[model samples]
Target: MWKILKYSFADLVRSRWSYVYLAFYLILGFSLLFLNNDLSKTVITLMNIVVVLTPMIGTIFGIMYFYSAREFTELLLAQPIKRRNIFLGQYLGIALSLSLSLVLGLGIPFLIYGIAQSSEIWDFGFLLLVGTFLTFIFTALSVNISLRNENKVKGFGYAILLWLVLAVIYDGIFLISLVLFDDYPLDRFTLAATMFNPIDLSRILVLLKLDISALLGYTGALFQNFFQGSGVFISLGMLVLWTVVPVKLLLRKAIRKDF
Candidate 1:
């Protein structure tokens, strides 16, 4: 597993797309800071981008990696290795590389701007953490999609559809549902709905931590009321579950799968 992980990470690091991702973030970080010297404001702008972009990119990368690595995966199946380990290692490698790209890409500019001396360090750290979590969650989801679909085009299509539903469509439905049933209490329903979608959960979690949930209006207030206390821990646990469940399911599938 470790060897596979090491090679996978190395291979990805050497890829052109990896460098492009890193460069893109580097430019984004520098540009955001240049446009706005306020770290807090920059973090907010980044939050919007991170919440949507990371998951989409992770989905795309996961699907592409799984399909591209098929030949390699087949070669590994002939070796004395557990199928789950192969997939898990590849999955982890991709997630870590992308997470690293995000952290360093955004972190470097912040550090140069003396973010360490500022009060927004923790907020910035939390942003990176959520980004990492999204990367893992979405990548695992994409891998699952890829594993189930042998056709590359169909796999890519499914992956994009998954991202779209989670990142965009889910929020639309949640809002419409809230509007349609505005008279009734929706605290529990809203909370459950947020938990079901990683993107929503992440946005709420970060905004709650930044103490800006109030800006979101009613739903924000509800999130603030709930997440301000021990609910934060619960939110974190859900994020962990979001990452773990898909990974576990994919691993199980990988084991019984015909390679």
Candidate 2:
């Protein structure tokens, strides 16, 4: 497994796309800091981009990696190695490569700007953490989609559709539902809804950490107050669940799947 993992990691790290991903982050980080010297404000702006963009990139990368490597993967399948190791290693390789791009891309700018001396270090770190979580979660989902669909086009469609629903459509539906039933109490409903969508849960979690109560409004305040001291921990737990379940499903499917 480690050997397979190492190979995949090395292979991806060497890809031109990997360098492009890294360069993109480097530019984004420098640009954001150049435009705004405020670290916290920069982090807030980044959170919006990270939450949506990371997942989409992860989804695209996951689908692309799995399909591109299909021939090699099939070759590996004929060997005595376990299917779980092969797929999981590939999945981890893609997720970690993307996470590395995000960290280095954003981390370098902040580090140079003196985030360590600033009060927003933890907030910045949490933002990166959330981005990493989103990457892993979406990568796992995309890999699962790829595993299920033998056709590359179909896999890409399903993966993008998954991202769209969670990132955009889900929020629209949630807001509409809230407006339609505004008269009734929605605290529980809101909380429950937030939990179901990793993106919403992550946004609320970061906003709560930033202590941006004004932006959080009613729902954010409720989450902050409801979770109280344990808000970050609870949200982290949910993100873990989001990442693990898809991974588990991926492993299971790989194990029983006919290559």
Candidate 3:
């Protein structure tokens, strides 16, 4: 398992796409800081970038990795190694490699700026955790879809559409709901709405930490107060659910697969 993980990490490190992804984030982070010397502005910019890019890269590369490794997976199945081990080893390897890239790409820059400006490290830490978990969640989803379907294009399309729905469409719905429920106790509804979309929860979590939840309106304040205590654990647990359930279903399918 260790050997497989080592090789998988090496492969990811050698991939030009990984470097390009890292460079893109690093440049974006630095550019934002250069453009705005304000710590709050830098943190907000970083949060937005992480929220948008982390899942995008994770899904795309994760699907590609699984699909491209079909031949390798087949060869491994021929060996004496257990199928479960191979599946888990590959999943962990990919998750770790991608998480490391995200940490380096976004976390490190945020840390440098945070320290220099004496910013709140907790907020930045929360951002890093969000990016890491988001990557894991999306990667698991993409890998599951890829394994279940033979066509890489279709699998990849599913991931993109899923992202769009969770990140964009869901928010649009939330806005419409806010308009419709103008007088009701909408705070609870907002919280319930967040449960339906991890992206919404993540965005609320980050902004709440930055003391910017007010921008989200009344429901945002409710989210801020509700998640302010043990909310971190709840959010983390939700992320774990997002990763585990899909992978569990996928693994069951893979084990029973004729390949």
Give me the displacement of residue 117 in model 2, in angstroms.
0.7
Residue-level lDDT of model 3, residues 66-135, one tens digit each, is: 9999899999999998777788778778888888877787666666776445756667777889998888
Off by over 4 Å in 1: 216-222
lDDT of each: 0.91, 0.90, 0.80
lDDT of 1 by residue, 1-259 (tens): 9899988999998899889999999999999999999999899999999999999989999999999999999999999998878888999999999998999999999999999999999989999999999999999999999999999999999999999999999899999999999999888899999999999999988887675666655665666667877778898899999999999999999998876
The lowest-lDDT stretch of 10 consecutive residues in candidate 2 is 211-220
* Residue 40 shift from truth in candidate 3, angstroms: 2.4
Best-to-worst ranking by TM-score: 1, 2, 3
Task: For each candidate, give its TM-score against the true structure.
Answer: 0.97, 0.96, 0.91
Which candidate model has the greater TM-score, 1 or 3? 1
Candidate 3 Cα outliers beyond 4 Å, as residue runs: 111-117, 181-184, 214-221
Return whichever of 1 and 2 wins on lDDT: 1
The residue ranges of model 2 lying beyond 4 angstroms of the native Cα positions read 214-221
